[model samples]
Target: MTQSKEIKKPSSGLAARIFRQQMFIPLAALFLLALFNFIMDPSFYRISFDYNSVGNPVLSGNIISILDAGSELAILAIGMTLVTAATGGQDISVGAAIAISGSVVLRVLCGTNSRPDTLQAPIFVAILVSCVVAMLFGAFNGMLVAYFRIQPMVATLILFTAGRSIAAWINNNELPIISDPSFGVFGGFIPGIPIPTPIFIAAGCMIVIALVLRFTNLGLYVQSVGINESSSRLNGLNPAFIKFLTFVVLGLCVAVAGLIKVSRFSSINYSVVAKDIEMDAILAVALGGNALSGGKFNMKASIIGAYVIQFLATTLYKFKVQSTALPAYKAVVVILLVVLSAPKVREYLARIGKQIRQKTHVKEAG
Candidate 1:
C-alpha cells in the first residue's frame, strides 16, 4: 500500500503542474467545448470528404469549419499576443487596417477599373503593395504609442476611426471585383488541395513567427520591456523600438488576414469587411490566460484560444442562435473566463488546494 501511494504521488504532482500551466485554461476550455458538443450532438464531430463547386475534394463538417473559419483569427491572435505583451494593451485598429489593406490590393489589381476582366498586376505584386501600406500605417500608430507615449488603444483609435475612409479613398469609394480565378485560391481551396487555403496561410505565418522567436531575442526583449520599461532600458534594451516593432508585426498580420478576407469574396465591402474582428482577436489574447496588463505570454495558448473562440461561435450558430445576439452570448462567456483567470481568483484556488492537500496528508497519517 505504501509503495502504491508513493507511485501515485509523482503522477498527481505532474497533473497539478500541468493544471497550473498557462496553457491549462485554453486547453481545458477546448476539451469542455468538445465534450459538450459530443454530448449534445455526436454529429458535430463528423467529417466527410466532399467536392466543392470547382470539383475539388474537401473536408466538411463542424470541426473543419471551425478550423477553416478560425484561421484568420488565429493569425491575428499571433500578432495581438506580441502587441499585448509589449504594449500591455490591445490594438483596436486591426479590423480597419484590414479594410485598408484589402482596398489597396483591389486598387492595385484593378488599376482604375471598378470591374477588371484581368488583373492589372500580378497578385503577388498587389499583395506586396498592400503589405507595405499596412506596415506604414502600423508605423504611424507605433510612433504615437512608442515615441509620443500615447496609450496603445488611444493611438490605434485614430486609425480605427478613419482607416475605412482612407480605404475607400484608395479606390475612389469603388468596389472592384477580380475576375481572375487565381485570386480566389487564397481564401478558398487550391487545385487538388483538400484543406482550405487560408489554413495553409495561417500555418505558414505560425511557422515564421515560431522561427523568429526561436532564432532571435525578440521574445525575450518584448517580455522584458513589457514587464518593466525602465528596467529594460537600464538593461540596454530599447523599449520604444521593441514596442514599435510589435505594432509593425501586427500590421503584417493584418495585411495577410485582409488578403484572405478579400480573396474569399474576390471583392471588398468598405463598411462590413472584417468588422468587429479586432474585438475577437483581443478576446483571444485574454482567453489564452495571458495578462492584459503585460508580462510573460504563451503564444501557443493564444493560438489555441483563437480556435476555442471559433469553436464557441460555430457551436452557437449550430443551435440557430440569431446573429445579432451572438455578441451578447459571447460577452457573458468572456466575463466568466476573465474572472476565473484573474490573479486573485487563481491565488485563492491555489490556497484552497494546498489546504485540501494538507488535510489529505493528515488523514493518511491517521
Candidate 2:
C-alpha cells in the first residue's frame, strides 16, 4: 500500500501543477463541455461526410459545425488577445470593423452595380483592398489610444457607433451581391475537400501568428509593455508603437474574418453582418484565463476558448434555445467562468488541495 501511494504521488503532483497553469481553465472548460454533450447525447460527437448542393464532399455534424462556424471567432480571438494584452482593455469596435471590411470587399467586387453578373475585380484584389481598408481603420483606433492616450474601449467606441453607417455609406447605401461561385469557396468548402474553407483560413492565420511569435520578439514586447509600460519604455521598448502595432495586427485579423463573413453569403448586410461579435471575442479572451486588465496571455487558450463558445452555442441550439435567449444563457455561463477563473478563487482552491494532500499523507503514514 505504501509503495502504491508513493508511486501515485508524482502523477498527482503533475496534475496539480497542470491545474495551476493558465491554459488549465480553457482546457477544463473544453473538457466539461465535451463531457456534457456526451452525457446529454453521444450523437453530438458524430462526424460524417456528405455532398453539398455543389456536389462537394464536406464534413457535417455538431462538432464540425463548431469548428466551421467558430473560425471567424477564433481568428478574431487571436487579434483580440494581443490587443487586450497590450492595451489592457478590450476593443468594442471589431464587429463594426468587420462590417466595414466586408463592405469594402463587396464594393470592390461589385463595382458600380448592386448585383453584379461578374466580379469587377479579381477575388485577391478585393481581399487586398479590404485588408488595407481594415488596417487603416485599425491604425486610426490605435492613433487615438496610443498617441492621444484615450481609453481603448472608448477609443474604439467611435468606430463602433458609426462603423455600420460608414459601411452603408461606402457603397452608397446599396447591398452588393457577388454572383461568382469562386468567391463562395472562401467561406464554403473547396472541390474534393471534406473540410470547410474557413477552417483552413483560420489555420493559416494561426500558423502565421505562430511563426511570428516563434521568430520574433513581438510576444515578449507585448507582454512586457502590458505588464509595465513605464518599465518597458525604460528597457528600450517603444510602448506606444507596440500598442499601436497590436491594433493594426488586430485590423488585419478583422479583414480576414470579414472576408469569411461576406463570402459565406456572397453579399453584405450593413447592420446585420458580424453584429455583437466583439463581446464574444472579448469573452474568449477572458475565458482563456487572460487577465481583463492585461499582463500575460495564452494565444492558444484564447483560440480554444473561441471554439468552446461556439460549442456552447451549438449545444444551446440543439436544446431548442431561442436565438433571442441565447445571449442571456451565455451570459450566465460567462459569469460562472469568470468567477471561477478569478485569482482569489484559484488561490483558495489551491489551499484546499494542499490541505487535502497533506491529510492524505498523514493517513497513509498512520
lDDT of 2: 0.93
Q: Evaluate all candidate structures by whole-model CA lDDT and list the values in order.
A: 0.93, 0.93
Once fitted onto the true fold, the runs of candidate 1 whose alpha carbons sit more than 4 angstroms away are 1-12, 360-366
List the candidate 2 regions with Cα displacement exceeding 4 Å: 1-12, 356-366
Lowest summed-lDDT stretch of 10 residues in model 2?
1-10
For model 1, how does the per-residue alpha-carbon lDDT over 2-55 read when each residue is reduced to its tens digit? Answer: 334344788767776897889999999999999999999999999999998879
**Model 1 Cα RMSD, Å?**
2.2
Report how far off residue 336 is in candidate 2 (Å): 1.1
Report the C-alpha lDDT of model 2 over 104-167, residue by residue, as the tens digit: 9999999998898998989899999999999999999999999999999999999999999999
lDDT of 1 at 174: 82
Clashing pairs in 1: none
Top candidate, metric lDDT? 2
